[model samples]
Target: MPLRNPCALLPRRLQVVASLTLAVLLFILLLGSHPTSTSSTDYIHRVPYGPAIQSSAHQLVENLPQIPHDLPHVNTPAWLNPFRGPAHTPPPEQANSSSGEARWYTDFKWRNPFSSDTTLDEERAVLPPLAERARVYTYFESTSKDDKTKKIELELLQVWRRAWWAQGFKPIVLGKPEAMNNPLYRAVQGLELEDAMEKEMMRWLAWGNMGTGILSNWLAVPMAAKDDTLLEFLRRGEFPSLTWYKGLESGMFVGSRGEIEKAVKEAIAFPAINTTKSMFEAVGKETFAVEADHGAIAFYSSATITAKYPLLATKLSSPSTAVQGLALLPQLINSHLHTTWQNTFSSGIAVLKPLPAHTTTLIQPALDIARNLSQCPSTPIPASCPPNKPRCKPCVSNNMLISVPPVLRNTSSLFTIATVPHPYTLTSLLHSRLDLGVKFVRRETDRDSWTVAATKELLGTGLSSFSRLPALKDFVAGSYGEARTLWLVAEEPVRGDSELDLDALDWHFGFQLPRSPVSDGKSVTPVPGPERRPPPPKEEFGEGPPLSEQELMTERSMFMQAQMILRDSATGSAKGKTRGGSKSFAQTREVVEAWNLADTEVWRFVRAWDARRQLERRGWEEEEEGFLGKGTFGRWIDKIT
Candidate 1:
């Protein structure tokens, strides 16, 4: 039927469409029958070289002697190894060893062909005893020529000595006079330098002449001084010269005595304009620098020096800055502060002043009353008195006196008694008793403590309304002694039909009660209960509101305040009193001074933390486009959520 002109049955347009379809089918069949040439050309274009070159290379490889199946494959390119040699045959003594071991021995011998047998034996031996090699020397020069600077330098040396001693290394701090006496220093002192800075920097070279062990800057605190592998390597006689940071050799380093002396002497002999530059360059290979900026100022200085002298660049063994920069600074500061605080505040007893709202004018009067009642003579009953005579309690009962604050009188009984063998012990005993009473009241009551309740109530009125409260204004403006008065009260069981007087206590403590039981004595005011709301509708799509600056600031403030309070409480100020009760007035004052000093440190840490956050925020802002697509808004959303 196709042969009988099938197009004749169709219209002109249909005939034209049929003809076009037949042509396309024929073209497809032709392409399918002979796709080899096209595919080959495409593959050749995709590959590295043309078909002719590939074939020639393949032929050449095939004609070459085949590598033994037992031979290990190397990562070298085929072109580089055009003439593949036979596998290396080890000596009969090493024939039993593995291929890798043989190769290592070969490489070692090739690298150190001129090494003596004794030197090789020493290098192969295990690390020597730590006592023979654990010496770390540092040079201490006061940046300023004042007595205060000298004192600070001495303190820094003491800190360094303690730190290194803890790490099993004998730390030596060399001063200017000691450096001047050293032959190495004398040798370099005569050399002309471009400026005073170069002359000052030349002192570091003396450290190299002092030892075969590690040389460290005064500010370079050790992080891994006890690392076994590192110590073992450093103890080796043939150990290579190692530098920290960007290989500037200014922070810390360790090497053989000869290598260090050689580097130092070479640096001194070299007539360079900048002696510091020459010294750093002549040192050794760069390893890793400390990541922290705490006591690692030496590493930073080295990095800066390297930046200024790009010619000293070398491949770093490790890219990481060793320690955590953000966390370590505050940790070091806190550690130092804690040590000082413990030394100053270790007394068994201390006197703590109450917060501003806790102090009251009533404390002195109560003290006077207690003193009088304690000293009152007891009444004695006459032996001849009749049995019907009414018996009365003594003025001073059981040799103890009790005092109660008016606010707590209806709700609870409060008393404070201190017993001591000697009159001199009375003051500490009284402080202990009052501290215990204050703690007991605070723990038993619900936000009824003067400071807590008053502050909450004042804050509830809003920041703008603070001026409306005259008591708060006076509390803020009053003297420290006037504002922080102690109220001696002890919790006791309430007797009789007395009920808790919440209203009276709240009024006394300056707390604004949220609700009253009765309004004007006519109608009862309903207490507001927790409101019940309907469940939120399920969100099909869309995001919540991004964290605002106000919310961020509020959260940061709360976090910092909580940290400060926790740190303060950890100092044992909130621990009431010790059982020994032997602290004198001077000891108490020392305790107070310690707390003040610690508080200052805590605030300083808070400021540093805030500053770090600001720096991180600035970094995020700078990288917003690449990191967060929507800039600041996106960054905030990303960070908060």
Candidate 2:
């Protein structure tokens, strides 16, 4: 008793020590879990590489940092922009990068832009001169109305010039025989392809040279101007600047706000469903009286949940008529021939919902057979499809009309009226390097990286399908003489500021949204920088009050420097409350309808739905019968059977 057993005492002592050790370890683990953002340029990608600094390599991804901690409000810290999610957090510092020219041909097989420095031979190959006169882009005010098709043509030709995309770059885009000169091509042209080929073809056809329409698009200008230093105007198929001259036919010039607005407007379109009285009797004799609103709700929910389709909207706006009437009077005969096809196929649905299991049971079978060889593989297809042939898998039914058709099925007119043509004023202006842009007095790389990171994340999260997802073209479209600094904007939505009215009728929600930076799948990492306060915003708009969120977005698009600070229009504040507003019955329904019309987009979800159908098509016939009759996508069909 006097001396406790020595062994026992030793055991007790060891137990105490072990408890203490465990506690300490837990403390360290907890501390490590706490998010701590360091103010360091360690993770920043400061590439001497041309313009773009968003790192693509995985190792360059810093720790997946939560949205930055101390970003200046004026910097319009991305975190404050509500609607951002965890995946949107910036990557912690330590991301490293060296000044390397952006390798243009990284993914493509034929091109290797990164192998060696830009070789003289390669450079020459991309930009071959043809005519003695190099083409120069010119911006002008048009006296007539905007021409939609012409606008696309101008943009298409210019993009080819800048990106060095030729006819070869264009995938067959649907080759099989068509009842009307490629229904697939016509169906997706303006709404998707942007009519690049038609513009080139029109140019040739107008000149009585139908055979060489594509050749004309090559834009064969001479290597050098008469003075010899190479045409100062054209480079590698691109004419950056719009040549300003008299009698050059007036063209449309919508401000930066207008372009952005066009984008947003397209996001808002939805099919109008008649919320009139309709009776949906259950499979049993129990028929309940259904209200119009209830019917719409039921139909929309059933369509979305069953098909998983997202509605889509398209901007129906025409480009400004700053320039009209071609220099070479467009041949009426050829114009008719080229445009006739477009008119026939120029239409697309703004909203298309998938059929319910009951309807799809009848329709999808036909669609699967009809669409068997027209869709692209590799890319995920819409929800409804037969298995094994995702690329061109046939649908269960083809003659099955969509949930509802808007302008798409409304072509009661005899001629397919394609939209008018307009030039790519924006790109042309930039190519010429006319040197129009606000000068950034200070340099801030950190700000730029953050902006790029957020943009990439958004695109990856499904915004890529949006027609107006801003990319390399939107950011660096126009030329700024040696753009030194990019602005990190915290410009908020304040009333009474007037430089740009993003809320103006056509300029509001729908149009402005087109330029929203997209997010690709990339870890969010803070941009590196010397960390100085951004200089006072240039007073280009005079002593007006601070601009509202919409206005700020428009201005940012035009300037192309500052990262925009937008209040979620769904919630008119920048406090990062993360709250989303529910539109009224009508408004909300519209968005749902928009999601349904997504032939190309909502198709992924539909394909998912269709996979269930394929599963149903094969065997599983023993499943239960009747409405809930265990159609495709039936989870317990086999179990029930």
Candidate 3:
């Protein structure tokens, strides 16, 4: 005590100075403010997050199909699923013609689950296999001088977790660094490491204005692949790119598998457009939309394109890139047949962008350039149509066409991964891909229209849980740590909005029916900007708008030379499922309900809790390890319960 008095009781002036410093600090915190700090990993959302909202909207539980009683359920889809009408038509052309939609859904070639060794990355890494809550974790394994990055990482995960849990998701997360299992996280526990973390989320929305592939970049971010390229591409600023893009925005194009085929076929009637080795880049993107700090191709161009060609992508493969790789060749072929332009590659006329799946129709734009721009007839140069396709009279022979190597990348596997929530609806999503196509529509972003009918129904049911949602409230409250298992729903994009409402914890969740895409203001939401593109131009490049009969015949003649280029994505490959596929969000709900409503192993664990026994009376690990010991999700549920 005497020693404590000596130093602690420094000179009166020194003590006064210290007190003043502390007071100033308090005053600055209470009155003035400093710029909030964020982590690099506070990272631009690795995926486009769905519109966040807490409302009385939900789909009726009755519409959900029963869990398959067997290890495999027939690919048969239930009515009212993502597929529209009783026929569950994926494409009118084939829905009525195909024997079973089963042939349309294919299996996955691989499923890369979340894996990480770094402590900092423990919370925001890995490509979770679940559908709804794929989380990410990052590590700042830097020197003592680099603790700032580590703190930022931790802060980012915490804020993300808060946002996700508040949105009612049982997130598959990369939790607090201290909670990390890595050896390093253990060493940094005593310091105020989290002090510099930022609590605010920087708000912004990204429309994949990058004209081509949003998938590769989205999936690459969590993998720590170059993300600046994607951000730059979106900004329209040139960055190091495998290729340059001169295409239109996706939202501007009207897409549909069969419809595209129909349009292309009709356009093919034009003696002008030729189809050779059909060239189109998948511009792969993971379509999950939300980032959980884990890895994944959050949304590839295919996912975006599929949003328009739901029935087609669904009929093709699940979200796992592995599955897509297996079906890649086939999917491309299919898309080619539907889109109609021949191989611009062999003919030096491939879509200005090589990959077509991830992009929209720019046939007219390509045609416009062909008309106005002049090219060296002998070279497969940019700006002009190829000179070599079956001698289209407009050009001569000997033009060397620029060619893309027919070799698919190691596609041995793409360098991509997507974290998905588990016991998820991979199957449902697979089926929903083709089968659920009719439910959502383009521009169906209104909050009040029937377009939101399905979402309203879902949130409506989820809101009922609000009465028992104290745990959810506590999680969101952040100040109070309350944990309880509650209903979670992810349907923001269905009704489309940017910010989420905070007080939606106590409302009942509901669902409404899907309406036509043509809703009057009833379905339109105010998008911050505009949707503009020019119409097809008449009068192109050289000879008067009219090419002589010989030229028209020559242009038409080019089609036969590049026949292989016409792939038809409209009719997706055999519908299949694989060991590598992810679970769907819808499937996640069903699984949760199945466990809650029936006698199951998960329920068994929940029932073993003996809350009445005194802590001292039981052995250390044996008694309390009931529900928490099962698995990550099991522990998560017990926390919320």
Go through the candidates in order and give the C-alpha RMSD of each one to the true structure.
35.6, 32.6, 38.1
What lDDT score is found at residue 540 in candidate 3? Answer: 17
What ranges in model 1 sit over 4 Å off? 1-133, 182-187, 195-201, 224-249, 274-278, 281-641
Q: What are the runs in model 3 whose C-alpha is more than 4 Å off?
A: 1-182, 191-541, 548-557, 564-641
Against the true structure, whose lDDT is highest?
1
Poorest stretch of ten by lDDT in candidate 1: 417-426
Q: For candidate 3, write residues 1-641 as lDDT tens digits.
A: 33465437688889888888989999988886644695455556553354422221234455677775347656655663766555322321212111211111111211112111211121121111112322222112222233433343333333333332332222222123213432323322422322221100000001111122221221112111222233222323222232222221121121222322332223223332232211121112221122222221122245444553344456445544433342332222222211111221123321122112211121222322222111222111112221112222222221323222211111111210111111112212212222222122122212112111112322343432222222222221122211111111111111111222211221111011111111222221122221311122222122224345564444333322211111111132223232335433233233333332211111111111111011112232243245232654312112221
lDDT of 3 at 632: 43
CA-lDDT, candidates in order: 0.35, 0.22, 0.24
Worst 10 residues of 2 by lDDT: 415-424
lDDT of 2 by residue, 1-641 (tens): 48774445567878788778879999999886733574335435443344344454433567555575446666355579688554333222221110121111111111221111222221111111112212222111112344544443343333223221111111011111111232223322333212333332222122221111111122211111111222122223232221211111111011122222232222222121112111111011121111121110011111222243221101111123313222111111112211221222222111211111111111212222112111111111223221111132222221212122111122222111011000111211122221212121012111122112223432443443232122321221112200110111012111111223212211111111111111331111111221311122122213336446575444335323211111122233323211243222222222322332222112222222222222322222233222121342311111111
Ranking by lDDT: 1, 3, 2
Alpha carbon lDDT of residue 373, candidate 2?
13
Compared with the true structure, model 1 gives a TM-score of 0.26
As a whole number from 0 to 100, the lDDT of residue 482 in candidate 1 is 17
RMSD of 3: 38.1
lDDT of model number 2: 0.22
lDDT string for model 1 (121-200, tens) is 21121111113326677765545444443444454444454455433355565545445555687666676665554544
